[model samples]
Target: MDIIKKRRSVREYLDKPVEDEKIEQIVEAARLAPSSCNSQCWRFVVTKGDIKEQIIKKGLGGIVLANRWAKSAPAIIVACADLNFLTHKVGAGIKGIEYHLLDIGIAVEHLILRATELGLGTCWIGWFNEREVRKILKIPRSIKIVALITLGYPKGELELHEKQRLDLKKILFWNKYGNCEG
Candidate 1:
């Protein structure tokens, strides 16, 4: 819970480099996330230095706000999933496709939590141009890019903002969807 509360979408980063061993540990955590039918179709592309810069540029080409923060991150982990491997085993159906995406999401969350525990910061980036990113990374067509994660040591403390959320009383119901005060 400490790691969950401390984790934030950190955009600013220090110039220091993250250790290779720490990166490996973070990846290991992601590898251990539960996958549907234990297919484990996810693959990670770890980028640093010049490669990281190129990916950031290509991925953020259309998003102005994201480009600013992504440029500062010391490393970027692009999560991709082999679509064929995940769905083929399940046969032809939409359920298999859904499982692949769900599995990727779970894996990425595990990565973020592990990074937080290691005193590192990460931001889940979803607004990137996926087609451009695939070209930049030379990712084959067989895989679907799930997300691009930016990682580094935070430049400063995270400031909490007062964001609106649905109250439990309004959202929770005894058994059905519209009933409140159950």
Candidate 2:
């Protein structure tokens, strides 16, 4: 199986810390991710130690209880997009498409996949108070927070079961929606 297929969204993590070199690899994957029109507007804020704790306990605000499991993770990577890029401005103006968010999403997937390949656990977090996170990270208001990914080692024996997904026949159509053979 491909590493991408093996990747799972892990919530529980061991208290062990991720090595700096591994972190570098994960960030490098994000850096190399393809961006729409090569906008490369994604920005990542890596939180460790005390800052990591603060992000979980405070930055997440009332949603903390829902994602409390991630608080134990040794590192939390916050993904953001710098909307100041010319492609973002032009695309949004001309086509009403937000390419920066797409770029950030692709970059985050790369980071998470790299972490998983390196034997690290990761959980992608999107529900939270963006304002609070931006304030805590000291990010400028012009930037848009995209997502958060927590990283660490697995807490126990890891196993992979068959993933539940829609059948290809049910989701795929030859030419358009409802065009599949009946």
Say which candidate scores most in TM-score.
Answer: 2
Q: Which residue pairs in model 1 clash with each other?
A: none
In the range 1-182, model 1's lDDT, one tens digit per residue, is 66777788888899988998999999999999998878898899999988887787777876545455788889999999898773545643754457878889999999999998888989998888888889888999989998989999989864444446687678777768877533
lDDT of 2 by residue, 31-76 (tens): 9999988878988898999888878887776855688778788999
Q: What's model 2's TM-score?
A: 0.92
User: What is each predicted model's overall lDDT from 0 to 1?
Assistant: 0.84, 0.85
